[model samples]
Target: MTERQILLVKNSWSYVIVKSEEAGQLFYHRLFEIAPELKSLFKSEPKGQSRKLINMVTLMVSKLQKLDEIQGEIKSLATRHHKYGVDPAYYRIVGAAFLWTLQQGLKDKWNEELEEAWVDMYAVISNAMIKNQQAVAA
Candidate 1:
């Protein structure tokens, strides 16, 4: 991603981060709406799960420019995700829900540039997480 794109995501994220709780709630609500079958994969309470989601996203967004630095962590997260029932195909749906949630939160601040920037960032992160996984260990 270009430095301009990275700045766009970070700058827009700053506006919405203040209401992260609501953002997390919206994300899960929208996610379940789109992929109800995936809801069963979650083992924690909704509130706690939301906190975990937001916290991880916050960490990732902060490190967007140096995603390689967090590659190990991202891959480990992928392993946990596999154990939690996330399939390789599900990243697309997750990205959709994530982008939609960001739009809902950012409102007027949401634009094509920010959306594209986020798409780029998510692609990089998801690729890192998925590149090493062939199958979930039994």
Candidate 2:
């Protein structure tokens, strides 16, 4: 998938539209199911963490259409995540959970096109975050 196709998915309401109180809980549940050990890192109430996740993701997606404008914000987020000890593998976990949520959220509408769009989009965003993290390390 091209970057444009990826952006089409990112700018969609797929993330924010389906974003609900229950969605967060479901995300955590699915996340733990895939990566049980990561559960220990979230030392807060599930609801609180889920809210944070929802808000953070919403903000990120909202800014995706203007990535150049949000470069600093993205860098800051990546830096903070680094301090939190979030590595590439952890990103994979979150991405997987996110995709699962969309799949469940969109149901029949969730086609291979959407899946590829999300995968490509994740690669773009994750690489940007990694680059930002590396820049900070340098």
Q: Distance (Å) between predicted and true CA of 33, model 2?
A: 0.9
Candidate 2 residue 99 Cα shift, in angstroms, is 0.8
Name the regions of candidate 1 deviating beyond 4 angstroms.
Answer: 135-138
Worst 10 residues of 2 by lDDT: 10-19
For each candidate, the alpha-carbon lDDT, in order, equals 0.86, 0.77
TM-score of each: 0.94, 0.82
lDDT of 2 by residue, 88-116 (tens): 66888788998897788767777888788
Candidate 1 lDDT by residue in tens digits, 11-57: 88887789988998999999999999989999899889989988888
lDDT of 2 at 112: 85
lDDT of 2 at 94: 85
> 40 in model 1: Cα distance from truth in Å?
0.4
Worst 10 residues of 1 by lDDT: 129-138
Per candidate, the number of residue pairs that clash is 0, 0
